[model samples]
Target: MTNTALTGVIPPVCTPLTPSYEVDTGSLTRLVDHLVAGGVDALFLLGSTSEVAFLPDRHRKVVLDTVVGHVAGQVPVLAGVIDMTTPRVLDHVDTAVAAGVDAIVATAPFYARTHPAEIRAHFRAIAARAGRPLYAYDLPVSVHTKLGTDLVLDLAAEGVLAGVKDSSGDDGGLRAVILGRRERADIADFSVLTGSELTVDSALWMGASGVVPGLGNVDPHGYVRLVRAARAGDWAAARAEQERLFHLFELVTVGGTRMGGSSSALGAFKAALHLRGVIDHPTTAPPQIPLDEDETARVGKYLAAGGLI
Candidate 1:
C-alpha cells in the first residue's frame, strides 16, 4: 500500500456485535459504508470505539480484515494498534499492514506511565516496520501517559509521524500544537485532531485537521458537516451544528463514562448506533457494561430529540 497521511474526520468506529456477543461483520460493514457515504475521510476500526483492549487477538484481526475488505481501497483505513509493550504494538502494526491498512493510529501505553523517550521509541519502531504513515493518538484521558506538544512536534519533525489525534482535551496543548505549526512554516500541514465532540468546531477553527469524536457513531453526517463547514470557514453554521450535538456529547460523557466503569461512554455510543439502525446490535465487549434499560431510555430520549434516531 502507498503511504498516506491520515486526515479529516476519522470515526473510531464502534464495534457492532450481536445480542449473542458474536462479531457482527455485516453490521460493521454497513456502518463503514454509511460513514463513507456520509463522507468520512477514514475508518478507525478496532480503536477505543471498537474496544481494542477487550477484544481477543483473533477478533481484532477479523474486524480489521472485514473493514479493509469492505472499504476495498475507496478510502484510507487507520488500524488502531494500541498496546502496553513495544513488541506487541509492532506485531499488531505488522498484522494491520498485512491486512492492507493504509496507516496506524496508536496510543501511548496505558497504566504504565511511559516517558517520552519510550513513547517515541515505541512509535518509531512501529513506523519503521509498517512502511506506512502513523497518527499519534494522544489521549491522555483514556491512556494515562501524556504525549505533550514538544514530544509530538519532535516526532513529526522526524518525518515518519504524520500527525496527532489530540484527544488530551487540553486546550492548552491543542493551542501549542496549532501554534507550533504557525511558528514553523515547514510543518504546518501536520494535523492536530480533536477527540472530543465539544471541541470539534473550535479545534478546526484553531487549525486542527479534523476530529475523531465518539458521538459521530450516532450522527456521522452532523460531525462530518461540522468539520467540513469549519474548514470552509462557516463559523455560524459550524457553531449551530456543534450546539445541536453538544447535548448528546454531554449525555454520553456524564459520570466520567470514558474511563472504565459500568456506565461506559463506549457502550452508550454503540447503543446509540444500534438505536439508529446503522448497526444491528449494541453489545460492548466484556468488562464494559451495557446501558441498562433506564439509561438506554434516557439516551434514546436525547437522541430522538436530537433527531439522531
Candidate 2:
C-alpha cells in the first residue's frame, strides 16, 4: 500500500547475548550474514523476537547498527520501532534511518489501546513525518491493541499506510483487510503477510506476498521449502510440512513453559538457535524467567525429539 516495497520471509531476529547478558555484537553480525546468505528476503532487527522492549536504548542502537553494517545492501533491513510514544517512535525512525535501515515495523502503543480514529491519526502522523515506509505490525497478543481493517483501509486511502503484517492469529481478521482492498482500489497494492507458520501456505494461496514467521528464526531452510511449495501450489507437500511446523509451534507456545501466565516461546526459540550455534547464548531479558537447568534440559529434549534442534 502507498507505493511501499516489502515482502517475503522477514524473521524478527533474536538479540543474541553473552552469558553475562551483554549484547553479543559479533554473534549478531554472524547471524545476519548467515540469514542473508541463507536466502531470506529481508531482515527485521529489534523486533519482539529481538526482545527490543526490555533491551536498553544503547543496546538497541548497537543491534541496529550491527545489522545495517553487516547487511551492506545485501538485502533490505527493517528496524523495529518499539517506542510506545509518538514522539519517541518518530525519533526512532530518524535514528534508524541514520543507521541505514530501509524501512520500519511498528505496532500500536502498548497499554494505550488507541481507537480506530486515534490509530489512523497516529500512523498518519508517523508516515507523514517518516522518511521510509512503515509496516503496520498488528500483534494484539503482545500489545493488546489490534489494527482494525477500517483503520488500515483508511490509512491506505490517505496514502500514509504501508502494508500490514497481520499476526493477529485470526484468518478472518487477515482476510478482512484483503477483501477490503477489493472495495477500494487505493489499497490494491496493500500487501498482507501472515504471521503464523501454519497458515503460511494458505495465506499465500489466498494472495499474501510472503510471511514473517517466528519459526524461520530457527529453521529458515524449512520455511523456505514451505514457501516454495506453497508458491508452486503443491498442496500435497505443503500440507504435510505445515503439519510438522504446527507441532513445533504448539510445542514452543504451550509445552515446557512458565515463569508467568504466558508460555516461553521466545526462550525456547532462542535455546534452539543457540543449540544450532546461530546465537551464542539464549539469554532472555530480565523479568522474563529463563528456563532453569531442568527446564532447559526439558526444552532441549523436546526440540531434539521434534528434530527442531
Candidate 3:
C-alpha cells in the first residue's frame, strides 16, 4: 500500500557491498540515512542503480531487509522486482512484500520474445498478485520492450499500474503519459516518474511527478535541490542545478574503454561514495570490474567540482 504519493527526488539507493560481494548492512544503513538527511521524499531500493539485476536472491533479501529496517517508515521504499517473466518476478514480489517494501517495481519480461499484448498481460498479472502498489518500470534498453504511451495510459486507467518509472528515454512517450494523466480524470492520481538523470528538469517541466535519478545515490542533496527548484517554478535555479548535476554525471564515463556501461556508471557511483566516506570499499559485484585508481581519482575530481568532496 502506497501511504504517500511518490514524488520529489527518490534516489535509486545504491547497495553498498563488501569486498566478498556480500551486502554491507552498515554502509547500506548509512547510505539510507544520508538520503533521508539530504531530504529525499522516498527511497528506491534494489533498482537497477542498486545492482538489482546482478544481485543473488540472498543478497537481494539482505538489501531489502536492511533498507526497510533502517528506514522504518520515514519514507516509502520501492523495491525492484526485476526478472525474466511473470513467475520469476512474482517470486521476487512476494519476497519484497514480505520484507515490507511500500511498493514493487517490475519491468517487462526479458530474455524471451513477447508481444505487446503479452506485456500488458504481464503487468496485469503481477499487479493482481503483488499485494502492494506496483510501478511499471519501462526500461526498453534492458527489457527490449518499449512500453507504448497509449498502453501505459490504458494501464494507468485500468489501475493495474499505480505509476510508471520512465527510463525508456523516450521523451515523447513520457510527455504523453504526463499530459494524459492531466487530461484523463481517471488517471489523475497515477504518478509518472523519470529515471533519466540527463533530462530531469525537462521531465519535471513536462509534468513528471518526480525523478528516480541514479546519480542521486552519490549526491542526494544535489537532486533534492534540483527537485525543489523545479517545483518552486524557479527555472533558472533548476537549470543551474541540473547543469551542475550534468557536469557531475561525467564521472560515469571515467572508467572509459575498459568497462561496460553498468560497470563504469555504477563503479563511478560507488567510487564517489567511497571518496565521500559513505562506504568502506568501492568494489562492485563480481564479473563487473572495479574502477582503477585513476578512474576513482577522476570520480573524486567530479565530486570536488560538484562541491561534494
Best-performing candidate as measured by TM-score:
3
Q: Which scores higher on lDDT, 1 or 2?
A: 1
- Tens-digit lDDT string for candidate 3 (1-309): 452389898899898999988899999998898899999998998889999989999999999998898888998999999999989998998889899999888999999999989999999998898767889999999989998888888988888888999999899999888888888887757889999998899999999989999999898998999999998999999999999999999999998989899999999999999899888888798799899999998899999999998
Candidates' lDDT values, in order?
A: 0.80, 0.77, 0.90
In angstroms, the error of model 1 at 174 is 0.8
Report the backbone clash tally of model 1.
Answer: 0
lDDT ranking, best first: 3, 1, 2
Could you tell which candidate, 2 or 3, scores higher by TM-score?
3
lDDT per residue, candidate 1, 159-247, as tens digits? 76888887777888898988996787556457777888887888887777788877787788899888788878899999999999997
Over 4 Å off in model 3, which ranges?
Answer: 1-4
lDDT tens digits, residue span 147-251, model 2: 888888888777676678888998988888878866786665676778887788788777777888777787777677777887777987878777777776654
In model 2, residue pairs whose N, Cα or C atoms come closer than 3 Å (at least 3 residues apart or on different chains), thus clashing, are none
Q: List the residue pairs that clash in candidate 1.
A: none
What is the lDDT for 97 in model 2? 79
In candidate 2, stretches whose alpha carbon ends up further than 4 angstroms from where it belongs are: 1-5, 253-257, 261-263, 305-309
The candidate with the higher TM-score, 1 or 3, is 3
| lDDT over C-alpha atoms for residue 197 of model 2 | 73
